[model samples]
Target: MRKDWQNLAPAHGLNALVENGTIENLEVKDHVANILETNGVDLNDVEGVIWSHWHFDHTGDPSTFPSSTKLIVGPGFSEVFTPGYPADKNGHCLESDFAGRELQEIDFSGSDVTIGRFKAFDYFRDGSFYILDAPGHTIGHINALARTNASPNPGFIHLGGDSVHHAAEIRPSEYLPLPESIEPSPVPKLHSNACPGHIFAPVLKDGSKTEHILEWQDPWAEFVEPKFGLIYNEKDLRETVRKDEELDANRDIFTFIAHDWSLKGVVDEFPKSLNGWKNKGWKETTRWLYLRDFQAAVV
Candidate 1:
């Protein structure tokens, strides 16, 4: 229904999962600093940089930010990634990123607040933002739940950092089942505006029937294997995804993963706030857009 193919591309073209790539090829035209500057935001005003985990891709060129900007990380981050790069020799991060800045690690052991089975830390005290301990992808991996509004019917945006790579990992659950028919097919070049959901049945995991998109016992049935085998704890990651599915099912919450290609053109970009997502109908539009990735298999 929405004709915005300008941002639509094959899943591979939009995928951020890189393996054994050179820095030159991986370089992007705009970094966080560039985006902030474009929006008339000064780097000096940024008080803190929160890292979901110490992964190379997630930790952008932090050295660009002003030293006054504190670098916040999850628990066990210091124990492992501290004394970065040259000093540690085998560290994943560079010392320059933390040289003159204060690197603060989040310790959730004392926090009693819990949100959707996760140990939460109210970053702003005012329920507006919360940092959740979501481990599995790596040690001290965390996710964020941001309250978009304060009204009686408030909406939340769950920033799922590497909790799951694709929407298929957490979608089509008991709470959000696949529709019998999908309108405005995700395949960009398709002439038909609607796609039958049964086409994807052939690609479902073994023993999974078309009756349900994904079963509780096997949620990742339609997901692809990770390009890089960097999962720190597969078992814990499964549990984290299970909890994520619950949050995704909540009508008021929008679960957005770091690498979700479905949201490319659907959600508003930075400079445009995602505050009124519910009113804008962002969830309904983008929820099933990931189905486009299966175009090759289904066709």
Candidate 2:
């Protein structure tokens, strides 16, 4: 049987992705650990751990799993973490750290790994679920896609890993509150190239003898971060919406930024049985509710 699914990394650790500058929240880690414990699945038994990227939020609990488990990383997992473009102190881990664990390095030959012209990660052999590689939010950033059998058309549950932030950032009609300190002017043309977000970037022109480097707009810029609202400045959520619309056109692609408040119900409703969860009941301290009614909605 297929390994059961769990909210490995659920709950908004980062405060409000919209107004708060917190990129990731520690609380999310607590939630992830709690979810695992609630399901009665020992962290030591986790056979594999897939890290979409080296972002702190995603890699918060790298040490939690057993050293014997396999760890899967994206194309430049090692490069991005150590002596890479923009080195992050908390974002990556060295090979030596794993010791005896297996490491699966997926280097899509520099091509996007998703289905349909982009980086897509499929689970099992069914293609019902997938992970989309969408950098720019980070060097190796990716998004999760879940196609529920409930609908004839694709019913995608996009777990956006900072690729596209809150829905307000994508909603064209939403009025965003922009800080006056931050200008409304276009991001410098050269800035985008200097930054690593562009999937295609920094072109070299002229002859090899005297190479002249020129930068061009990335066609996939929309997928990175689009101009839809004030908060969407970092990512082109518009592109994400467009791509999501194209592939899962029925409009069932549910977009959930890591920190969205609405996720409380979704995470709570996540099948405990699938993850081997044994604990139940609401908590008065966190005001957390494990409503049977909500759990019944999973099917």
Candidate 3:
């Protein structure tokens, strides 16, 4: 989120989790600074802090904010957000102080809970600008969808939270570098001459199925390489199942993730905002140009 050196943690021993070249250490404050510069959105004005799950990068600088800020974390934020986590599994940065501010943990025990303005959040009604149910990344993993309502299609611009990392990961392209904790194997490109459509599901078809879209095993498929363990084998599967069931129940809601880098390109190509925020949603608009536009702007 914050693109500053100070925000990056010192590499001391994060080699266990990240691939080569990832920043190892950064401070809570430094990331806050980057958030301020890039998005121009005032952190002080952030009405709520919805941490999809408690990962270091996602929870970068939690303490910098005032305690009054309501923190929305998974039900098990306490258990997984601790020092023994795989990334911090070495017991190095396990100090509880890493969580800058006290958290208001929101547990979703397969039930609808009122968070903010929506009636039945997580899968009850049409989610507002900042919430969704996307578990699986963590036992308590979830997704948050935000929109300003100014766009012609507010339903189209959903913030997926961390359920997905980037757009390429979801698009018909090759798989991007996945986090080892989630997928342990390298993503294969199938075959050299294969079209991107080749990555879609249901490898075979017949008159039994019928039509241009024949027998799809998985419609929203991504070539996952679960690093922590197989999705069905892990102990966290129960929670994952509960969350997925809820998401499927309310599948009509349009949501997007919070940290997708490619989303800005889509945002830039088509920027819209709900009526609530002034100057459209560009309160912090500087860092959002398309890749070339951003490069040229800096040049």
Candidate 4:
């Protein structure tokens, strides 16, 4: 995305949804820039930036940094979306986005390693970070898993970009089962220690109902608006659901999706290290909170 401070609307809002609906007064900032400034890091200090997918939200503004900043993307990105925008006449990428930069397209096929349910590629080759093939939300979608703490027993911080949007998609799975209890979070503006899990079932068009994982009393079953319109292919979506269930089951992995509204203000912001997520009990506090969105389903 070009940093056109002049017409800031396009940079922030999803123009594709304008006809159906959109929100005004929404301004998307260059988060990469925000992180750099907050940490007192220079632009040139950034070695590279990898995108989980080619979506507008994930791509952000690579042009804002120096021409030297390497732009890394998942496989098939160039073939699927090269000669961007005006050049391709039908592409979603902007030519200026990759102009004069060292573009690296990573291929995860034929990899020998598998972490959890994902085929993993060790980024640093030192066991610190990895790029996992995470398809579903889009073509060539990927995710990152970083070993944040590694003393007695290692813990991971998973950057789950667009893999799953809601707790419903990631909850009650075999790997990460619902916790028995949770501590209250200050951000939700609540002062408390204990909150229980909320699980619900969905009614079918035939008027029959399917049971939830544990049949815990639930006021909300997952009902994402179909109008929001996703572009996930069959194979990708299937793999996504399969692997997400695995990731959700694992206790050591802290997976953060691209647009998890439940995470906002609940977790630490940038410039604050999330390295201690395990010690702080972030997963416990935020896990069942998405059930709050089910309020509409409750009578």
Most TM-score-accurate candidate: 1
- Compared with the true structure, all predictions reach lDDT values of 0.74, 0.42, 0.39, 0.65
TM-score of each: 0.82, 0.50, 0.48, 0.79
Write the residue-wise lDDT of candidate 4 on 1-299 in tens digits: 32343232332235634434554554555556665767898988887888888756677677777898898887777786677655666556777678899888877876777888788898778889888888766667888888988968678888887776665566655555444444452223332555443212321112222211221121212332211124345456656666866775577878787767877777898778898888888876677666556534432
By the lDDT metric, which is better: model 2 or model 4?
A: 4
RMSD in Å for model 4: 6.1
Q: By TM-score, how accurate is candidate 4?
A: 0.79
Sorting all predicted structures by lDDT, with the top scorer first, yields 1, 4, 2, 3
**CA-RMSD of model 2:** 17.0
> Which residue runs of candidate 1 sit more than 4 Å off their true CA positions?
1-24, 187-191, 207-229
Off by over 4 Å in 3: 1-30, 37-42, 82-100, 113-130, 150-156, 166-264, 269-299
Clash count, one per candidate? 0, 14, 35, 3
Best by lDDT: 1
Tell me, what's the RMSD of every candidate? 7.7, 17.0, 11.9, 6.1
Tens-place lDDT per residue, model 3, 181-254, is 21111122322221232222232122111112211122213443332222312434333333422332232333
